[model samples]
Target: MTVNDGTATGTTHGSMADAELVSTEVLLAKPKRVVREDLKMPDGRVIDWYFMDTPDSVMVVPLTNDGRLVFVRQYRHNLKKHCIELPAGAVSAGEDPAEAALRELEEETGYRLAEGEELVSLGRFYSLPSETNKYTNFYFARVTWDHEPILDNEIEAYFDMSVVTIPAADVFSRLAGEINGMETAGALMLSQRYIAAA
Candidate 1:
């Protein structure tokens, strides 16, 4: 597909950065949405309404030549439960998704990638359309080490997401319910497309 620089309107074949939609109009405006606070059917009732615009984020599935996929199992105080998600976080001010993924990988997982193998951009994703305007970029990092992964301070204490691998053949099972996060799911979906093409 024909592509535009710094736009994601309809581009399908260019570098993702070229297609990464950064339209100020789309990014700047508050979400144009409404929530109804009161509902009257056969009986009159009231509830609540809220409007929100979610943040831009990133998700990663760090891989090593030895065939390990970095997975983080953390306690989500908000959800009040633990989920096995890949390392991830929101993109910071003026930060690129790929760069954020790399930094988050090191900060959360402490596994360094070899100098050359960097992120292969998967694509952009939207989360929770009902209330969020967030976009998450998926990334893959290749590690060169042959040992167990080390963990960062807060991550080590709050969550037990030590890097581990699910066999290539068992991905559908391991990552089935919630073994991965939203971005991880997106990345795996893209990777499946890559594998199918091969």
Candidate 2:
């Protein structure tokens, strides 16, 4: 199938039929924007699709020199619980994904790339294509916690952020249980492939 979005045309080879976007309504615009889209199906059916319209973000898996994984345990209001996950944050406008990953690692866990260390890009993935347009870049880096964390006001106010370290080998097992977030789990799984190849 081919789609012409007024500027460029692209062909998609897929079994599922495409839905034409009819209209869009902005539901919320603060913190993050929520949008509702009306679509017309190929079969003359109409549907409403709700999703978040936001900038891309980054997630970092920081491995210490001692071979430990750095994570953050933060309170998630939506879940009403503290969840452990990799350091992550939205990429500000005009900011590079790698830079955002490094900034988040420092801000969340006080870990910074040491001399000769680098932030390695694992690649990017959709946060949830069915629900949003936000894509998150995944990164891995060897770091050192030589300074105190400098939490942003929003994070400090909204979450009780605490840095946690664990053996890097235990990440897969912890992710299989309830000790990690899905995004972290996904990033770690991808990191395994990179580690294996290295």
Candidate 3:
């Protein structure tokens, strides 16, 4: 449940339970999507809640046969900083999360699953539970560098993205300092069991 004390009109105080969505207002649409949801609480209070209406996404922890982890270092305009993150993307409508994970891994880092290899499920997690409906399915793939990274021109021009690799052994040591994206961090953490066994 999304809890907010600040509303569009004023501030409210209380823990709302079993609130009904009364209405929604699309505040901003597209690349940075935001929506205001008016919820009717059981106490007859209608509170305005704001959140990002984001699609589900997929993140892949790509490991190479040589014990290296493929990563993407990209500029996030919102953060105005280059972030090192795992290969990830929004799940297109009607597309499977596992399929999207493989596709994103190849596109962002030029890594593909080795022959006879399949994606190992890492589980689904909320990107930002209190702010959006977006959830990301995580996967661990044993991959090999097959080709050059294929990034969309628009994204490349805007984000200046590039692929990078690090030893799997050193990844966990640089968690918060070198790699800070929430989704990326979660992906790596979830892949720990598989990485240990590999």
Candidate 4:
């Protein structure tokens, strides 16, 4: 069947035969898209579903040749606090996820893969399957300091981000404490498995 509410339209296919979209209202836009969608069920009942529409991104778990994990400390305006997280960033339009991982590593931590070092893919994950469509691709890389971190102008001015390096062995212990982002923790788990298997 088909449903439209002036601004948005939705159609039900074979798998969604029992559900139909009634309407959709955009709550927030831009970098993070949030919306409220109304749906009609097979029982003639309507319900509201709120979700986020975000672009896929990449997260890097950078390891220095000497076995240090490269992290970044930055202010999170939403939390009104500083957070320690892995080097990560959004994958630019038409850019490869691996390339984005490498770029974020260098941009946020001033670290880049050495001549013989390589970027290893751990895998990809949905940051919040129920709430957002954003998938984060994870990678493990051994890097060396090449230059100072170059943050985006807004990040530099508002977040005051700084690079922090810690022993890879300490990651688990740190994760047991108050880590900020769930995506970062998930990335750590995947990277740990990758390291163990290698």
lDDT of 2 by residue, 68-147 (tens): 88899899998998889999999999998899999989988999987797788988898778888989999988888878
Model 3 TM-score relative to the real fold: 0.88
**What's the residue-level lDDT of 50 in candidate 2?**
94
TM-score of 4: 0.83
What tens-digit string does per-residue lDDT give for candidate 3 at 76-131? 88898999999888999899988898988988888899999989998888867688
Model 1's alpha-carbon lDDT is: 0.62
The lDDT per prediction is 0.62, 0.83, 0.86, 0.82
Q: What are the per-model numbers of colliding residue pairs?
A: 1, 0, 0, 0
Query: How many backbone overlaps does candidate 3 show?
Result: 0
Give RMSD to native, each candidate.
Answer: 11.3, 5.8, 5.4, 7.5
Q: Write one digit per residue (lDDT tens) for candidate 1, span 1-198.
A: 335666445433433223322222233343233333332322223333343455678887666665556666778777888877777876877988788887777766676676687677777878776675678888766755444545556446666556555654566566657665656666777776533332
Candidate 1 accuracy as TM-score? 0.63
Lowest lDDT 10-residue stretch of candidate 4: 8-17
Record all residue pairs in model 2 with backbone atoms less than 3 Å apart, i.e. clashing: none
Expressed as tens digits, the lDDT of each residue in 1-198 for candidate 4 is 344645545534222346699999999886578989888887677778899978789999888767788899999988898999999888988999999999989888899987797788988888777888889998998788999988887655579799998887777788847564898888888888654433
Q: How much lDDT does candidate 3 score?
A: 0.86
- Is candidate 2 or 3 superior in lDDT? 3
Among the numbered candidates, top lDDT falls to: 3
Residue pairs in candidate 4 whose N, alpha carbon or C atoms collide under 3 angstroms: none
Error of model 4, residue 14, in angstroms: 14
Give the better candidate number (2 or 3) by TM-score: 3
